[model samples]
Target: MKTFARTMLAIVGGYVGTSAIIAALAGIAVAAGGMERSEAATLTSMLGFVIYLAVIIWSFADPALLRVALGLGAVSGLSYAVVLLLARAPV
Candidate 1:
């Protein structure tokens, strides 16, 4: 039961965390207008998948359940803040 709980938590945390990170990055890139919109979309799609895989591997490999949760939560929260700030910035 404990193992199952940890696994589920890790999966959820990784998914949410990875998504938030990707969104934050993509938003920043878009706001900066560094790349063409289509290129950004393509890059985001490919990079998002890679990030998800990495998060999954890391989540399960790390034995510290609390660390996994807290780390992800922190990253997600920080990412959210960054995205929000970027959104409000003058374009």
Candidate 2:
């Protein structure tokens, strides 16, 4: 049960964290290239999926690494949130 919770938390954290990173990058790309939101969302979703897989693989292979990974993932998510907000700020 504990392992399951850890895995679930990791998966969710990784997905959101990675998606935020991708979203920020996509936002920059959209601003520079004048891309549509739909296109940027699709690209971000794909990147998030890839990150999910990588994190899941690592989590299953090494349970002991879950704590560190989760901590780092949380930090990444927070940083991404800050970047997203800053990127969306009005000039």
Candidate 3:
């Protein structure tokens, strides 16, 4: 049961967390680097592959399932919040 849960979290949670992080990073790049939205998104999307792979590996490497869950949830939630704020900010 635990292994099943971990595998699911590694696949689903990692993807969700990675996506949120990529969005947040793109927002940051657009805001801070003054980059065009499309360029920022393209760069972040490419980087997201590596980030997602690392997330999946870490999810499995971490022995504590609860910690893995918490980390993923926290990061995903925080990144989503950043995305929301960025969307609301004036250009």
Cα-based lDDT at residue 11, candidate 2 = 81
Roughly what TM-score does model 1 have, to 2 decimal places? 0.81
Number of clashes in every candidate structure? 0, 0, 0
Write candidate 2's Cα lDDT for 1-91 as tens digits.
8787767766876666666667776776567667787997788768777876776676667657657476657767775876667577773
Tens digits of per-residue lDDT for model 3 on 1-91?
9999989998998999999999999999999889999999999999999999998999899999899899889989999999999899998
Point out where model 1 deviates above 4 Å. none
TM-score order of candidates, top first = 3, 1, 2
Colliding residue pairs in candidate 3? none
Model 3 / residue 37 / CA error / Å: 1.3
Highest lDDT, which number? 3
Q: Candidates' lDDT values, in order?
A: 0.78, 0.70, 0.94
TM-score of 3: 0.96
Query: If ranked by lDDT, best first, what sequence of candidates would result?
Result: 3, 1, 2
Model 3 stretches with alpha carbons more than 4 Å out = none
Which stretch of 10 consecutive residues in model 1 shows the poorest summed lDDT? 33-42
